[model samples]
Target: MVRTLLALKGALVRGALAQLLAAEDDIDVVGEADTPDELRSALRAERPDVAVVDGDLVTADQLGDLASDRPAGCPDGGPPGRLLVLVQQRRAARLGPVLAQHSRRIGFLSHDVAPGRIVEGVRQLADGRVVLDPDLVVAALAVADSPLTPREREVLDVAAEGHPVRDIAERLVLSAGTVRNHLSRIMAKTGARTRLEAVRIARESGWI
Candidate 1:
């Protein structure tokens, strides 16, 4: 079984995750703490296999303190797993550099992820890897209808080619539904009803 540590705010959020993880045969909720202090204590004592830390737990020096050492397995014997941050929203831009700086040590997830997805993330993070839910990733990239990034522009360009979401998704290595969803968002941003119209407007406005 994978031993886990949960560091989140809000009684409700903690309760929900606790119940869900408790039911999993493969997961063991070794510790639960509310703030940075309590969380630090729990971490030191438990040395959990994976740490699902909410962004609210700490930041800057406090956050750095918690992350002072790499993730370690329970009992402090085997190599450490990983520390995954659960944020209220995607802090992609802000975390991009930080994550790069600590590539093998950090990962992120949205606080609203489904229970099953959260468990799955625990398994992955405990094994040391990056895992961000797709829908949240899309939402993060689509903020500020004001503009789209070059990568988003590329996703939109390939999606608008009438490639049929499935084929386009295959070509882009994105889920079919994700491709369609991106097209819908692109349409909304450009104030166009159809894919072609959206592409034309986006191109003219230099959004792509």
Candidate 2:
């Protein structure tokens, strides 16, 4: 049986990817959206067998926060239609929350992977199977035991943007001393000697 697919926007790369997938015998490209709002509309309207998305379409800073708030099931516990994601290496680390929430139906692929490999991932998702890039999985697993709390992550996220202690404190409504304390703990947890190093570690490990 032929499977229908809905693709979310990326750059020229995703257009090329659509062409590649459309050429597949078992897959039919059903819809494409250039924004998250449009994607939501297409998802409801098309209800394709598989939804292909580019990672940047989402603006959530931490999937862990979102996943924790919602049930660890499909929204409304509906049919387990698959979601295939194409993400950059750095952003791939953020997928741990999604993995925990939707284990077997979601797939992740590096944007730089070969078209043949990406088509294989799409086919796997369409067949009701899960697929994740090996290196991205390893990165997710490595950061699974993160020591920082959500508040700490927020503090570090501000710090990551080159903000000063006073500025981070003001943004989070905490005092400068409290912000410094959080940074100190973050450094200890990540084993970084300085705040900048800590931010680097957190980003690389997908903690932020």
Candidate 3:
């Protein structure tokens, strides 16, 4: 049997999917989680063969952490099981961080896909196959390359939320002058005359 864990944010959706997967003769619903903490706990305790996660509930960084913290005795020192992340097509860029790093054991599928597709995806993942939604692939490809460095992107992400230099610096643990310099470079890289415009450009291009 394919042991599966559901980790979507919506309780109704999670329950519905759990029921759907449980009906499959070859699949078993091992655990369900609605939050990152619960999901982490479920992963460690259940060690399901496949984990169906909602990208919004768990960030890519947190996914990386879970992958690295796989239960001891994982074959070849790799993650204990496969992960199938369900994300909206427009939000595909949010997965860029972990896509390349965990491509082998992680799959991305559009959340709007038919329930049957999700079931098939779990089976495929359990068999060590990659499943990617075409729309998500196109959306990921459409994101423009970001020119800003990691620190610049960090500043821009904060700026995108309308935070001023002082607030951004305080939140990032940097001085106001350093924040100003980062903003200046961000503007130069994105060719925006104002920080707000730079934020718009970065967001439109999915840099943040």
- Top-lDDT structure, candidate number: 3
Q: Could you arrange the candidates by lDDT from highest to lowest? A: 3, 2, 1
- The per-residue C-alpha lDDT of model 1 at residue 23 equals 95
Q: Where's the lowest-lDDT run of ten residues in candidate 2? A: 63-72
**Tens digits of per-residue lDDT for model 3 on 54-150?**
9767655677777667665556654678889998765666566567677778888998989999999999999998788877766655544768665
Q: What TM-score quantifies how close candidate 3 is to the native fold?
A: 0.75
Could you tell me how far off, in angstroms, the CA of residue 82 lies in candidate 3 after the best superposition?
A: 0.8
Cand. 3 Cα-lDDT: 0.81
Backbone clashes, each candidate? 1, 0, 0
**Model 2 stretches astray by more than 4 angstroms:** 1-8, 59-80, 149-198, 204-208
TM-score of each: 0.57, 0.66, 0.75
Worst 10 residues of 1 by lDDT: 90-99
- Where does model 3 exceed 4 Å of error? 72-79, 141-144, 148-199, 206-208
Candidate 1 on 1-208: residue-level lDDT in tens?
A: 8888888888898888888998999989988888777877787778887778886455523454455564345455444446777765523333333444554655677777667878888888777767765544544344345365434555665555566778766655668788777777777767888888877776555444
Alpha-carbon deviation at 154 in model 3, angstroms: 7.8
Tell me the tens digit of each residue's lDDT in model 2 across 1-208: 4455545555576577678888888888887876756766666566667777776564333222322232224477446356777777665545566766765766788878887987788778777677888877876565457787757867886687798999787766789999989998989999999998998888866776
Q: What overall lDDT goes with each candidate model?
A: 0.66, 0.69, 0.81
